[model samples]
Target: MTLASTGTVIEVETRAGRVRGAWRGTPGEGGASAAFLGIPFAEPPVGDLRFAAPMPKRPWEGTLDALEYAPTAQRGDPGVTLIPEPSIPGDSTLNVNVFTPAPGKTTALPVLVYIHGGGYFAGSPASPWYDGAAFNRDGVVTVSISYRLGFDGFGWIEDAPLNRGVLDWMLALEWVRDNIAAFGGDPARVTIAGQSAGGGAVLTLLGMPAAQPLFEAVYCISGAAADVSVDEAEAFGRRLAEAGGVTPDRAGLSSLSEERVLELQKQLTAPAEGGNPLDGLRQFVDGGLTLGPVIDGDLVPLKTVDAIRSGIGADKPLVLGATDDEFSMILSEAKDKLRWIPSRYLLGKVGLTGKARSAYVAANRTVAKKGTAAIVGRYLTDRMFRTLALRIIHARGEAPTWLYRFSWTSPTFGMAVHCIDVPFFFDCLAADKVDAIAGDHPPQSLADAVHAGAVNFITTGDPGWPRYTAASGETRVYDDPSTVIRDGYAEVASLLPS
Candidate 1:
C-alpha cells in the first residue's frame, strides 16, 4: 500500500497502469485529501467504437499523470442548468476521477461512485462541486465517472446495442471493483448514488438482475426513471433519422455527421409546430423518457418500480428521496401567466382533467392554497420525483430502506428547486457557483447535516434513521433542524395506490 501523505504527489497502481495524483492539504490539517483526475476506464468511443458498447482501455506502460479533468461526452457546456458543470471536447471521455485520503492503504475505506445527470443527454462529471475532497476527508474514497451521452450513447440503431450509457456505468463499476483497492477503497462497501437522471440510472440498475452484482447499496436523490419501451425507442430513432435525412439503422446513423445528429435531436425536442405551447408542457409531463435506458426485455427486463416490487434488489439497503420542490421553480415564470386562471383550469391545461385531476388536487390540498402555479409546480415535483419515491418505498416491502426529504427551502430560488439540494449532499458549499443557486450565504451547518447522513449511510448500512416499513412510513426530513416523521410522505400516500 502506497500512502499518499508523504508528498505533494501520490502514486497508485490500477489494473491498466500506474497513475500519479496531487494532494490538496497537509495531512496535519483536517479535511486533507488526494485527487487523481481523468483516469480512463474505457477506450475512446470514437470512429469504429462510436455508437457501440464501451470497451475497456488497454494496458499502458509508465505512470499516467492524472492531473486534470478529462474531456466529457457533452460537446461543450451549455451553461443552462443549475449545476456549473463544464464539458471539454475529446473522444476519450469515459473516465473516472478519484479522491482519497488514504491512498493504497491496506485498511479499506468505503467508496461512493457518483454519476452525473443531464436528462440522459447532457451533464459533465468534472464539476468542482463533484470534487471528492470532502468525502475523502470523511475517510471514504470518492469517484465520479463519465459516460457516452445523448444520441451517441442512447440513440437506437438496429445493429448496435441499446443502453450504451448503461453499459458504460456497469463497466465503470467493474473498474472500481477491480482497482479501487489500490486507492484504499473496499469494493464491497461501494455505494452508488446520483441525482435526477443520474438518480434514475442508479434506480434502473438496482432493478436490473445483471446489475445487482455491481454495488452493495444505493442512495437515490430525485431519481426519475426513463423506462423507455422498445417501441418508444424505435419511434424516436425513426424520427431522428427522418429529421437527419438518413436511414434509422446502424449504417445510415453511423454515416450522419455528429453535428447533424445533434441538430436533429433538437428538432425532436422542439415544440409542436402550429400547436399550443401548453400541449408541449403536457407532453413533457405525460411522455416518459424519449432517450435513456430502454426496457429491452433483457438488460432492463422490467420497469424500475416493477422490478423492485417483484423482489429484485430487495436485499440491498437503500435510501432514496428528493427535495420538497425538485422542479417547482420550473413554474415560477408560468405563475403570473397562470395567476388569473383557476387551479382546475391550469390543471386541465396540463392534461389533469376530470376525476384524476380532482383526486390529485384533493391529495395536494396544501399546495392548492399557494395558488395555481404552486399547485402545478408541486404536481411536477410529486409526479416526477416525490411520488415515485413513495412508490419505491411501498414496493421495497421490508427491505432495509430509509427515506428523506430535503425540505430546506433555498433563499436564492425561494423554493427547494431542482438541483438546490446537491451542494448540501456533497457538502461543497465552498465550491464555485454554489452561491448562484444556494444563495451567497448558503448554510454550511445544513451541508454538515446533509452530508453527515450521506457519509453515515455510505459507511454503515443505516443512516441514523429508522428504517421505513409498510406499517410505519418512517422518514428523515432535512430542514433547519432535521426531524424524523413517522410518515414523511403521508400527503403523498393519497397520491399512490394503497
Candidate 2:
C-alpha cells in the first residue's frame, strides 16, 4: 500500500465501493506526498436514519468523489475562534478524512486516528486544524472522523438506541480495521487519540468490549470515561419533552424539531435557580443518552472507573491528562458567579468532607495565583479534569499509564484554557476554517515538541515521560519549549473528592 503516484486520482476500494481521492503530490507545488479526503466510513445518519446505530454505507457503482469533506454533526453558533462549523442539513454526516504517504511499497506505518471533541455537542473531524497532511509527511497515516452530536447523538430515548454517537466511533474504527491497509496503515498498530469529549470517549472505549480490538494505544487530552447516569439522562429526556410541549414518551420526544431539541440542550448549560448547569444532565454516570457510554450489556457494562479499579483494562496502554486550567474556557461567562463557592462545597458533592475537603482546597489554593478569579478557575479545573485523571491513574493497577499536565498558557488568551493544547498538538499553526475552539498561534517549536511527544506515544508506547503509578508517582509537565518530568502532582490530584 505504499508509493502512490502524485497528482493522480487513486482508486480506493471501500466497503461503499470505489472512490477516487486526490493524489497528494510529493514535494511539488503543494506540500503533500499522498492524501485522501471525504471518505465514507458509514452510511449517512440523517432524516429517518438519525438516532439509529450506524449502518454500512451501500456501495456505489462508479468512483465516488473523495476530494471534499462530508458535512458534520449539528452545532449552535457559539462564535468561538477555532471550532468547526456544523453540518448542513441533508448532507451525509458520517464520514472520515484519511491522509497517508503515497501508498508506494513502503513498510507498514503506524496509524493515528483522531476524534474531535465538543462536549458531545459540537465538533467535526474535518476541522482545518485536524488536517493530517503533516503526519503523512512523516510517513504516518492519519485519520479524523465525524459523528452525530447533541440530542441527535446523545439524547436518552428509552425506545431508541443509546449512545449512538459512541457507536459511530466504533463503526469508524471497524472501517479502519477492514480498510486501512489499502492506505499503508497497519490496522493492528492503531492509536485512538482525542481531546475533551473525545478524550472521554477514549476512556470509555477502553472499557467497551466492542472497542478493544480496534487499537493498541490511546491518547486522551482532557476527557474521562464518566458520563451522565441513566436516571439523570431520563430527566434530560423529560426536559427535552417539556421543551417540545409533549409528554416524555419516546414517540412524543422523537417528534420534536431538531432546533427545539438543541434549545433544550442549551438550557442544560444555563444557570439554574440552585443547580449547576452541568449537574444532572452532564456525563457523570454510565447508561443513557446525553451520556455517550452506557452500561448496556453488549456495549459498556460498567463505569470506566469501576472497570479500571477491577483490573478489566489493565492490558491496555494509556496516555492521559489535561491542561493546567482546563476549566477557564468554560467559565468565561460565569467567572464572577464562581468566586465565593468554596472548593469544600464542591468536593462534598463527590462525597469527601472534613480533612479531605480542607486538604484539597488548601493544596489548590497554593498552586492557584493570588486572585479570586485565578483561584476559582484553578479550583474548577482541578475538580473537573485533574481529579478525573488522578482517579483513572490511581484506580488502574494493570496498565503502564503516562500522566501529564499542560501548563503553558496561550499568549493570545493568557491562559492555557480548555482545548488550548489542540492546535499545538496537531502542528496546525496556520490551518484555516477554525470555529469556536481556536487558540493563539503557536510557535513552530511548540507545535513540534507537542506533536512529537504525541507521535512518539503513538509510534512507540512511550511519550518520553514517566508513567504514573502508586509507587513512583511520577508526572510530566508539558510547556512551550520543554517537557519536564517530575513526581507528585498530588497537590492538584488531592483536591478530588474520594
Candidate 3:
C-alpha cells in the first residue's frame, strides 16, 4: 500500500498483523517522514521463552498501534553519559522501529537497519538520537531494533541457546526481509550498521553463514568482534549463577525474576572499590557479563576475524572505523585519577610493562601529551578498536572496504570520544538531550559529511572515498575539515606485538 501524505495516519499490513503509523511532517515542508514505533518482530522473550532463540511473532488480530517506543531489557541509569537512554517497562522487547519518507510506496528504497550499542549490556531504540527522520528526508528507510541484553542475552548456558542476542538480530533481519516491503523498504538493498557492540554485532553477523543474505553491506563504527569461547562463556554463566544463589542451568536461570537477573548483572559489572577507573575497562576486555557473540562451533563456527580471513562475507562492501580517543570517553569520570597511576603500573595490566611499555609510551608520546593517563588511554584505544578495525580491513579480501577515523574533538571532553559520532551519523544533533555530547552548536557540516557517507554506502555501496587497499592503507579522517591520511597509525602499529 502507498504511504499516506504528511500529517495523516496510515495503516499498513505486515505479515504478523496490521499497523497504524503517523507521518511526522508534510512532504512539501522538507520534513516528510513516517514513523512506525514498537512493532514486534519476534515473540516476547518472557517466561519460558526467556533464554531461547527468538521465535517468530504469532500473528495478531486487529491493527496494532505502532506509535510509541517499547521497553528494552532492564539496565541501570546511564548517569551523565554522552547518550540519553530512556527505559520503558514491558515484556515486548523484541521489537523494531521504522522511519520512511512520506507517501511510501512499493518503490523499494534502500533500507538501513541500525542496532544500538551499549557494550552489549544495555541500550535502547528509544534514544532520541536514533531518530530516523533525517534519513527519511534523504529518502532512505531507517530501522532501529531492540534485543535482549546482559545475562539474559549473552550469558552462555549448557541448556540455553548461545548468543541469543545475535539470534534476536537474525530474527529481526528476517522480519525486515519478510515485512519491510509494506513499509516501502527493499530488503535486497539492506545495509546493517551499528556502533560499539552493535558494530560488533554487524561483524558477528558477517561471520555467520545464516546472516550472509540478511544484509548487502556493513557500516561498523568502533565495533570489534567479541569471540568468547564456549568454555569461557559457560564459566562466566556459572559464576553469575553462583553469585545470584541459583543453579547454572536454564531452569534455574528462567526461575529468577528479571529484576533479580539484572541485579546480578550489575553486581558482575560494578567497579570494585579501591580499584583504578580502568578496572571496568579491564573487565570488559576480560569478558565481563557484557560477553558478546560466542564462537559456538555451530551458529558461529569461527572467530569473526578468522571467518573474515577465511572469506566469509568477503564480497560485501564494508565501512568500518573508530574515533581518535575512544578510551578517553570511557574513562572520562576518572581522568584526573588516571594521572596518579604510574605508567609502568598502568601498562602492567595489559602485559605491556618494561620495554614493551616503554616502546609504546615513546611511540604514543607525540600524540598523547597528557602523561601516563593519555598514554594508557591511547594504548587501549588502539589495542581494542583501531588495530581490530585494521585487522578486519586487511582481511576483507577483494571486497571494497573504506576505512575512517572520527577525530572531531568534543568541546567538553577535548577529544573525539566513544559514541560521539552517533548523533552526527544519524543527523540527530539537534535532538533533546544530545547537547551533552554535541555541545550547544555542533558542526552541521560534519554531520552532513558523516550522515551522507552512510547514506552513500547504503544506497550505492561506496562512501565517496577510494576503496581500501593493503598497499596504501588509506583512511578518511573526519575532523573540522575532513582529510584522507595514509596509514594514520603506522607508527603505533609497528610497536604492537603480533
Candidate 4:
C-alpha cells in the first residue's frame, strides 16, 4: 500500500496486532511524512513484571491508536535546560514511535532506530528534537524508542534479571524485525544510533551476541559502555536499596512507589562530599546509581569494551564521535571553584605528575588560556569521551569506522559542549529549542554538512571520509568550514591514565 494522503488515517498489521497512524504533514508539502507513535513493543514492566526482563506485549484483538506518544518511564524533573525533556505518566513506557515517507508500503526502506539519552536516568522518545520527519523525507524510516530506566531498568536486584533496559532495547528491535516491513522499513538494513547514555546502550548492544542480528550499523555519540564490575554494581545496588529504605531484592524494590525510587536515585547520584562538580555531569561519568548495563555473566557476558576488542561486531560499520568541549556545560556552573584549584592537583587526579603534567600543560596551551575550568573540562572530555572513541576505533579490528569531532562552539559557551550536535545531525536547527544551545541564526551550512554526512552513512556504508586507523588517526571536524584532521588529540593521548 502507498502512504495515506494529508490528514488521513493509515492502518498497518504487526505480529502482535494492528495499529492506526496519522499523516504528519500535508501531502506535496516539503516535510510530508507518516508518524506511528506510542506502539507498544513489550508488556509494561510494572507490578510483578518490574525489574524482570521485558516480556512480549500480549496480542490485542483491535487496532491500537498510534497517534499520540505513550507515557515514558518514571523519571525525576530535569529542571531547566535548552533541550526539551517531556515525560508522560503511565506503565506502557516500553513503546516505539515510527516515522516513514510511506506508511502502508511494502518497499523496504533503510531504517534508523534512535535511543534517547538522559544519563540512563531520565529522557524520553517524546522529545521534539528526536522527530524523524527529516529522516523520513530523506527516504529512510526512523524509529524512536522508550525503555525502562533507573532502578526498575538497571538496578541490580538480587533475584531479577540484570540489564532490563538492554532487554527492552532487544525486544524493541525484535518488534521492528517482525513488523517494520508493514511500515516500509527494511529489517535487515537497520542502523541503531543513540546519544550519551543511549549511545552507551548502542555500544553495549553491539557487544551482545543476541543483539548482533538486529542492526547492521551503529552511531555512538559522546558515550561508551558501562565499565562497572560485578562487585561494584552489587555494592551500588545495596547502597540504592538502603537509600530507598527497602531490602536489596526484587520484591522490596517492586514494593516501593516510583516516586520513592526516583527520590533515592537522585540522592544516590549526587556527587559525593567534596567531589568534583564535574563528576556526574557528562553521560560517561561514573555517577553512582545512574543505572547502566551490568556485565552479568549471561546477558552482558563481558564488559562492552572488552567484547569489542575481542572483535564482536568487528565487521559492522560504526560512526564514533565526541564534541571538543563536552564537559564545558557542567564546568560553566562551577567556574569560581575551578579557578581556585591548582593545576598540579587537577593533574594528580588523572595520575599525571612532574614532567608528564608539564608536557600536557605545555601542549594544551590553547585551553590553558580559558582557565582551570577549561583545563579540567578538556581533561574530562578526552578521558571520558575522546579517549573512549579512539579506543573503540582501535579495537574494532578492520571494521569500517568513521571518527568525528564536533567543534562548532556555541555562542553562549564558546565550546562545542555535549548534546550541541543533536540538532545539527537531525537537521532540526530550525527548532526553537536549538536556539537555546546553538544560539539564534546558527550556521545552516554546518548543519547541512553534518546531516548530509550522516544520511550518507545511513544510506550507504561510508560517510564520505577516510576510515579511521591507529596509524593515520584521521577525523572529520564539524565546524563552520568542516575539515579533516590527522591525529587530532595526539598530545592529550599520552596524558590519559591507564
Most TM-score-accurate candidate: 1
Which residue ranges in model 4 land beyond 4 Å of their true spot? 1-6, 28-30, 79-82, 273-290, 349-351, 496-498
Whole-model lDDT for model 2 versus the true structure?
0.71
Stretches of candidate 1 exceeding 4 Å from the true structure: 1-7, 27-29
TM-score of each: 0.96, 0.87, 0.94, 0.93
Cα-lDDT of candidate 1? 0.86
| lDDT digits (tens) for residues 289-404 of candidate 1 | 68898999998999989999999999999999998888778778878878898989877887767877788888778889888889888877887898899899878887889999
Write candidate 3's Cα lDDT for 114-229 as tens digits: 99888788778888888888888787899999899878888987688898998999999999999888888998999999988889989999888889999999999989677888
Top candidate, metric lDDT: 1
* Cα lDDT tens digits for candidate 2, 93-134: 888888876453335789999988877777667666777776
What are the Cα lDDT values of the candidates? 0.86, 0.71, 0.82, 0.81
Clashing pairs in 4: none
lDDT of 3 at 207: 83
Clashes (backbone N, CA, C under 3 Å), per candidate, total: 0, 24, 0, 0
Q: Name every residue pair that clashes in candidate 1.
A: none
